[model samples]
Target chain A: MKEKLTDSELIAMVNGGNQQAFSELMKRYRKMVARVVIGMLGDTPEADDVGQEVFVRFYQSISSFRGDSALGTYLTRIAINLSLNELNSRKRRFLFFSVKDDEQPLPDLADEANVDESLSRNELIEKALAHLDPKFRSVILLRLIEGYSTKETAEMLGVPLGTVLSRLTRAQDRLKEIVSKLSREMVINTADTTAKVKVKTELK
Target chain B: MKSKTFNPEKNIGNFFENYDADFKPFFETRVMARIENMVMSYQMNRDFAFRKIFMPALATLVVVFVLAVIMGQGISVQSLMGWTNIDMESAIASSMGY
Candidate 1:
């Protein structure tokens, strides 16, 4: 029965202190929130926490949710803001610790021979995304990945439309470079492994 | 040069359209749990604030009001500041030697 209710209806129920209604709303929008949060922060535990936080914040402010925009868009705006805050704190931690950028370990590359292909592809996507500045990443995720228009992206990020457009261009260029670099590295790693196998076979 | 063919714009769009980020099982349950915890803590904090800070503050204000009324001063800025006996016009005139 709750599934048939609209977002505004569920919001009204939630405002009336219906926790079940809020749960229904969460079930409705969890994927949208997950896309934004996971796109920005990658698929980490922190991303999960941030995803929960987006809905929690919405529930807290449900009374004031005037339905000025779509519920998905409002939750998305919160997700982006919280993700950016997480990124800022990550930057601060990196700076305070003076950690070398390269010293940051890759996601489980030690068993490259046994790694699954699709998993590696997703990892590659994430690594390339990590190279982008948060500003550019937000644009890429919103504009390209999540398929929001330039105007919507700008509004979500609280930037000018021109800024979103420019950032989208630069982010695409950077991602292309990073993806190409990663592909080359993958090819080289394969070649090195093949050469090692060949040398061992010949020696045997 | 191979990177030129790897258009991130088209590829990432296609990839992410099908990409379900590792959404954990029981996501709604976990989110609801967190919300419940948050609501619980918020109510606890509010109750604590009312008891610890607000109640004492209200009591002090009431005491001050009662004392003021008992002393025949009522409530005014001067009376609150214990400045009830000063005549400002004459005091200023005398200070200025008028």
Candidate 2:
């Protein structure tokens, strides 16, 4: 019967100090939260940190949940806000250190990634996605990766539907740009390694 | 070089469509433990605040009542603040028989 109860029912129980109900709620939605967060944050430790904070904040504010929106949406909204905060702070830190985006560029980031023939296409895409600006990456995460509707993504981001649309277009363009850079880096790195091997063979 | 028309939405889907978000086994345990700690700390804070603010006020009220009865005197915010408005003094003196 507990398993059959709706999100509102579980929330009511959680408000009444039922930890099991809260755990059930977390189990039900943690994967979705992880996808949205990890998509935006990659598989870094920061993603794990934000992922935990989402549920913790939800637990803290469980009493105020009126069920106006789906519980999933409510939780996803928290995840997005926290992830965006971390991204914004990171950008500020970068700015404080006088790191300009144009000066740093995507290929430079890809040069630091684990690129080899052993890497899958998915891994390559993930690495390419890391180079995307956080705003555009957020659009990609919510709209394309998580497959939320445009209106839903707008509501999640607290932006206009048209803004989500335009951001989606620009995000796609940026993703393409990064992937192209990634591919070019892949070629250059492969060639460089091969030339090194040829020189070693000649010396031998 | 052959130019490729980049389809972001489709490619993003391609990368993440089969994405599996696997949590370490301790994730749920860690979260539940944190939630419990949060609840405990919150209850502790409420109890602490109640003890901090309410107990002293209750004690002061009891002490004031006992002293007022013992001394046959009036207790009032006006008298406490040493204000001497005529109407207030008369009303308070009449009310407290002091």
Candidate 3:
């Protein structure tokens, strides 16, 4: 919305310590970064915190930004890296907490009310995303969801373009498999709704 | 195996598109605030660095001035430590190096 300035111009302004320019850069890419965070971590509150950390880190390092790729791509790469690290640490913490509190009940219904079937779809995709290794997940999110070109994805992730393509292929396959499994489960659950309704009506 | 009824790639893309409509508006604000905070913090740290260096230097200069006045003028250590301004000529003459 800020007239889509070239990355070089934005980089120049940021290096000159222009706070508003940095803010403008953020305004352009925050949604994309949040989506990447959510995609990597699934819609958890931690995503918001890590998403903020991502941009902060990007701002801190904007001076080092060379215009090898688009600014969004560069920032996305940083966001992905930080988000993955946060996700790893969170997973470790959860394991530790779980071990300490073996009897704690994990909540089952996270999103029960206002059941946008789309919400479930998002959750299913998120679950599948959680299954992939972080490296593959980064590529998949950048290319598929964020619509980065293969060359751009490779540069952003600091890998070869072929690696991006390969990982993208594998990630797509794994994601499809996960989504299919989830779809089947959703179908089975929906299929039993009539019987559940009849039982509830009978009890009433 | 279960019958392959769907293309997973297409499904994945479809899943993204399905929820894409729900993207909230404050996304840009969130990112901008993060960037601003980061730059602001870095600026604060640099300012702090300057202060940290400057304050100690200023303090050292003040200390050297106080010490030079106390010792260079042959003032008694006791009176200098006590913050008492003794007679400089008597103090120097008594020491026999005036």
Tell me the lDDT of candidate 2: 0.75
What clash pairs does model 3 have? Answer: none
Whole-model Cα lDDT per candidate? 0.78, 0.75, 0.68
DockQ, all candidates in order: 0.26, 0.30, 0.20
Q: Over all chains combined, what TM-score does candidate 1 have?
A: 0.72
Recovery fraction of native interface contacts for candidate 3: 0.39
Across residues B1-98, which tens digit of lDDT does each residue of candidate 3 receive?
A: 12224456565655566433123457557767666676578889989987999888888767766886766654455634545565988888979965
Task: For candidate 1, write residues B1-98 as lDDT tens digits.
Answer: 23324555466555444545656899888888988898899999999999999999999888888888899998997777677576899889989999
Which one wins by lDDT: 1 or 3? 1
What does candidate 2's lDDT look like per residue over A31-124, in tens digits?
A: 8898778766777888888899999999878898888888888888899899889877777877867556322355463554655534455556
Model 2, stretches more than 4 Å misplaced? Answer: A98-104, A108-117, A180-204, B1-12, B73-98
| Alpha carbon lDDT at A141, candidate 1 | 80
Greater DockQ among 1 and 3 belongs to: 1
Error of 2 at B26 (Å): 1.4
